[model samples]
Target: MDLEGLLGPQHPVAAAALISPAGVTVASRGADLDADFEIGSISKAVTGLLYADALERGEIRRESTLGELLPLGDVPAARVTLASLTQHRSGLPGLPRSARPLRRAIALWRHGTNPYGDNLEQLLTQARKVRVGRPRTRYSNFGFELLGHALAGAAGRSYGRLLHERVIDPLGLDHFYLPKAVDQLGPNALIGRNRRGEPRQPWTGEAIGPAGGIRSSVRGVARLVAALLDGSAAGIAALDPVAPFGKGARIGAGWITIEAEGRQITWHNGGTGGFRSWAGLDRDAGTGAVILSATSVSVDPFGLSLLTEHTRTVLNS
Candidate 1:
């Protein structure tokens, strides 16, 4: 499928994987399939899966609220429903209010310092002050962060532990991990680069793990997609659309579904200070594709093209 040609020479290191009924095929430009790259907001999709899994286990319900799970006191965020959070209808802001959000942004741009290094306790502290608006489909990192922690609290475990026990371990996704700190990253983890080609620090924190702090290899991502395709993933139902998102889009738990070229594509894209990732699935065609790059550039067009193009090939084949 000319992965190299599609990726071009801009990316310093990138990996791609395509899965179909024909089986899985993976290719990389500068890194091996086992090399991990921060998947940014794709972490939300993983959290979405965990959210569904917890629901199925009777540990949490769609009606669950921040007040019912975490010690957020009687804040407005506490009244937000799990279902609202999953579908981005919780009315929480994209990020919890910061004392100096502009300073954080400038630091990230100039120095690539991690801005979301808050731990669980700090996260709860910030959440307690959040003022949730009326329920509507608005993407919110803060909401997902809270949702993931709430799920963990319900199961009496940490978010990382719950993720491992419920998803990674069960699927044997050894390369998939959530690093609560930079020290937890392994040697195989790639150092991401900003658009200017400068190396950036890895984004890691317990507070942000659920929203934008997952790392994985292309192989790990492909295997996860295969499970989702075969309905073996514990939270397969999370991919089902529950509410309308932006124009011409519907969102499920964390995944967004859209119609393109007459094909329904369920997908998510992520970007941090230095990394970018895209994953998409055409379930009816049993085809999926993922693109991960160490450079902070958009991979959505490539991922969508690969999946849709691959779907046609699979149908013809």
Candidate 2:
């Protein structure tokens, strides 16, 4: 597991680690265990943990509607249940259909402009104009962003405050943070990298935080995933797989269950202007891995391989 090879000419700034159920680091490479990286949609998984924690605390239930927690009055999304949103069955559009979304996407890819600058107030204002679709297993950043804030409301706390109280502090995730600005990411956070290998701005701000604004070190992710393997309440709840998401995947609260090397892999991946991330677990094997890279090149395929093929190969050898 030296991964001495990761220091190759083509490798981007990255950190990869394997962890055991007993909370031990088996191997790692690329960046130091403490280096921070923007974890993109994997932020949703953390939000899911908060959602589940709310459920366990009896503040909300599976049947709780967004209309109750949020003021999305009479809209299609308001009728959607907490479970539906968590499972990606809300049918909320991936991005709230706004003016010139295509142009905005172009700006995102071409210029690395932050797609999510609207704060909570602005986000709620935009939500009022959104159109919800049929309930299906469609991934929706809008759904999660709203859901995160809604849950925070239900618990009488801000989303960041709630997450820190219930998840980060409990897990001792010293480095996990929802930065309101790029400078707050601090100097230790890895510089983001776009496909063209240029530095990119931090994809942060309150509106985007719940859906994709988490920053964390490799050790933080490893510890969080390890807790999942050990039956932590939020961890177990996040993998309930309430609905079938796609051909080889089940839409658990926030995690995706897919097949790899004849094994079922529970995983989530994140991508931003200049970063990519992956977290996966082979529950039956009692093993999991976390991968983060500054370059936007996806770590999904390689992350799955390490959790499946790589682990299999190592076991056999």
Please give the range of 10 consecutive residues that has the lowest summed lDDT in model 1. Answer: 95-104
lDDT of each: 0.89, 0.80
Q: Candidate 1 residues 1-317, lDDT tens each?
A: 46668988778699999999778899887888789999999999999999988898999888989899999888887888988989988888887665255787899999999888889999888888877787777788888999999999999999999999988998998499999898999879999999889999899999999999899999999999999998878898899988899999999899999998998999999999999999999989999999999999898899999998889988997
Least lDDT summed over 10 consecutive residues: which range in candidate 2?
2-11
Q: TM-score for model 2?
A: 0.92
- For residues 1-317, write the lDDT of model 2, one tens digit per residue: 54446323334578877866445553444456677889999999888888877877899998998889887667766787888888888878888766356777898877778777778887887677788788877888888998899899999989999888887888887478899877688557887878778778788889778889999988788888888888753647777666788786787778888878688888899998888889998888778888888888877777776677546744565
Every model's TM-score: 0.98, 0.92
Q: Compare the candidates by TM-score and give the number of the best one.
A: 1
| Cα lDDT over the full model 2 | 0.80
Query: For each candidate, C-alpha RMSD in Å?
Result: 1.1, 2.3
